[model samples]
Target: MRTTLWALPVVLSIGLGTGSLAQQRSVTTVGSVMQLMDAMTIPASNAVFNVGRQPPETDEEWSALALSAVVLAESGNLLLIRDRARDEAAWTEASQAMVEAGAAALGAVEARDVDALLDAGDVVFGSCEACHATYLKRE
Candidate 1:
């Protein structure tokens, strides 16, 4: 019984580890980078930026802001997907900046602070500009 129990745990661990590896290997991009930017990142960042001009008043408004911030933050992860990443070093740095700026926006929204949201918006804009300058093709 003791030996069986120990072996069972080992078997389960190996099975779970294999499943995890499989999931990692299967990670794929669903949308093109432009699609993701247009659908998620741009709108979300716009929401954060607009808060400076028209601060959220109702709970529902605040909740919407929260959702936008979350989408923005998660969009950074989407950019980091292996298929979407343009390069290793600069791409990773830019994506991480997006994540951090989004997080800051989320924090500001939670606090109901318009000024802080504006500051975070600036950071988000700077991150976007930095990445676009390096990667975006103008032609």
Candidate 2:
């Protein structure tokens, strides 16, 4: 009877602890990787892509450019989140590349430099393509 009582509490405690851990694991609010790319990355990057070809003329337009760069940079970090990374090293490298490219774009936008913005766009596109080629399995 003593052992039974003692073991019951131990088992219950472990069960409760694991249950909490499982709940914590399920707390990923960000949708799947594809959803993030479609909803956030694509739209934000479009803003950056439009910069040189259709340069921002107003403060509002410039603000949008800056916002896009910020989104891109942050989204790169988002890709590095647990379970989202396809391969740790490759994924980290690609995500860091995106951050660098986004930073470059932000710098160009701040400077209002069309040439630099265009170059930044190219870098951003290249980084995205490389990452996609490695991980994205198109259906």
Candidate 3:
């Protein structure tokens, strides 16, 4: 598949990022992260439809957002754990950027950050793409 589509995550224009989740943990945790990646599109789809419009302002929407963030974060954390040669800090920054990309996308639309909204579209995509590149390939 087109893994490159989500290769960037949320660049947030920062000095790259990574995650804090440690590797060599229980397999279940890693599996959970995989599951989260698998579920990533669920909330993102909802958010896409809701963005620039009346999002699911109810608890459901909030929950969806939170869920999305966790999945995104987990993948980033996984990346951090997987890539020994990969710079930890950069991965973490990238992971946060990925999270921020989604958040920024929503926030941009909420605050009408038209440019950010436009930029986030790709940023968020990169986040998903990047994670899939490493993890999905593993599976």
Candidate 4:
């Protein structure tokens, strides 16, 4: 019983993060966004890791699709705080690619087209690689 009680919120926070945890966690908006981004990455990593053997995404895969959308939304919101035109423009380009990647995934989930799914992967990769090139710098 105690285990169940403790587990409930943890389970919910997997898909929901703006409630009780927001207060006690000392988490800023930026932290919350980072958490959300982390959530998105898990499924994406799984999908890509299992690329060859996995079934194409489907409407039932809405969980992953939602994760991607949430990440992209946070990215768009970050644009509001960009300190320079170049930064804003770079983020804009990446955000667009993120959107295209997500939209393609959503469409592939509904349509079950492997080709479209592959294309979505490419767009996602392009945005990530491009942004990393400019901001992250290679190790």
Candidate 5:
């Protein structure tokens, strides 16, 4: 009887902890794949792309630029999520490209190099184009 009383609380705590673990991973996207891209990836990537045209002038602008690059990098991970990935090989390649492009953009932002940003922008756009051509082309 004494052992059961102690075990009961432990079991209940374990169950509660498991439930919270599931809640913590709340990014399981339920929307259409395109919607996810439109909502997050496209906008974040565009911010990086557009910054090349008008370079950041202030600390605040630089912060925003960095954040946009971070978002773009993280968006690639989002695409690789099991629920979002279409083809294992192709999706992995495309998402990895996004990650690499975002990293380049972030590095350029850190260095405040307009030319490098332009190069990174080309990479970012090309990555998106390649992926879309293969997997996301509208039928």
Candidate 6:
């Protein structure tokens, strides 16, 4: 059975519009973007990661996992918003990696494939680590 991801279109529209609108508007701060990651992306990634230990058993569980993946993917778009981007090259690369990883997780979740979800979780973890290594400030 094919699963429907309700938020995918919304996320796609936002990502598609970012290039043109990003330069025209400055809506959020990098800190705010990070907060979005902490609140949404990280948890979503955890759900993907946890799939190895406890795979979703029901349709509701699967749908919830799909939502998590959507959140993780959309968070990448949020990071790409010009106002929140840290730099031109590396930041863009890392953000795109995040988007791809999230998308992969979503696909795996839709397929109900445990192994692919785990692989996507690895990509998600790598993207997070790379970005943090490059940009995260320490006191």
- Taking all chains together, each candidate's TM-score versus the true structure is 0.82, 0.76, 0.44, 0.54, 0.75, 0.79
In terms of lDDT, the best-performing candidate is 1
By lDDT rank, best first, the candidates go 1, 6, 2, 5, 4, 3
lDDT comparing candidate 3 with the true structure: 0.53
lDDT for each of the candidates?
Answer: 0.89, 0.85, 0.53, 0.55, 0.84, 0.86
Which ten contiguous residues of candidate 2 have the minimum total lDDT? 20-29
RMSD of 2: 11.2
Error of 2 at 28 (Å): 2.8
Per-residue alpha-carbon lDDT of candidate 4 for residues 1-139, written as tens digits (9 for 90 to 100) = 9999999878788646654343355433443434534655445534632444675456556456445545554453443342321454676687566666666665664566666666666666776676657765557
Summarize candidate 3's per-residue lDDT along 1-139 as a digit string, tens digits: 3665565454322323432223444433334544544566445534543444654456676565555544544444454445321454544566666766666665655554455655766777776666456535452
Better of 2 and 6 by TM-score: 6
Model 1 C-alpha lDDT per residue in residues 59-105, reported as the tens digit of each score:
99999999999999989988987768888788878888999999999
Candidate 2 residues 24-47, lDDT tens each?
A: 565475598879898878998999
Model 4 worst lDDT run, 10 consecutive residues: 76-85
Question: Which segments of model 4 are wrong by more than 4 Å?
Answer: 1-28, 32-37, 45-49, 57-86
lDDT of 6: 0.86
Give the root-mean-square deviation of each candidate in angstroms.
Answer: 5.5, 11.2, 12.4, 10.7, 8.3, 7.0
Which digits, one per residue and each the tens of the lDDT, describe model 6 over residues 13-124? Answer: 8868785645666564546866887898888888888888999999999999999999998889888886688888888899999999999999999999989999999999
Better of 3 and 4 by lDDT: 4
TM-score of 6: 0.79
By lDDT, is 2 or 3 better?
A: 2
Q: Is candidate 2 or candidate 6 better by lDDT?
A: 6
* Per-candidate count of clashing residue pairs (backbone under 3 Å): 0, 0, 17, 0, 0, 0
Clashing pairs in 6: none
- How do the residues 1-139 of candidate 5 rate in per-residue lDDT, one tens digit apiece? 9999989989779779786443356666776768768887889898987875688899899889898898898888778776677776877798999999998999999998889998999999988987888886576
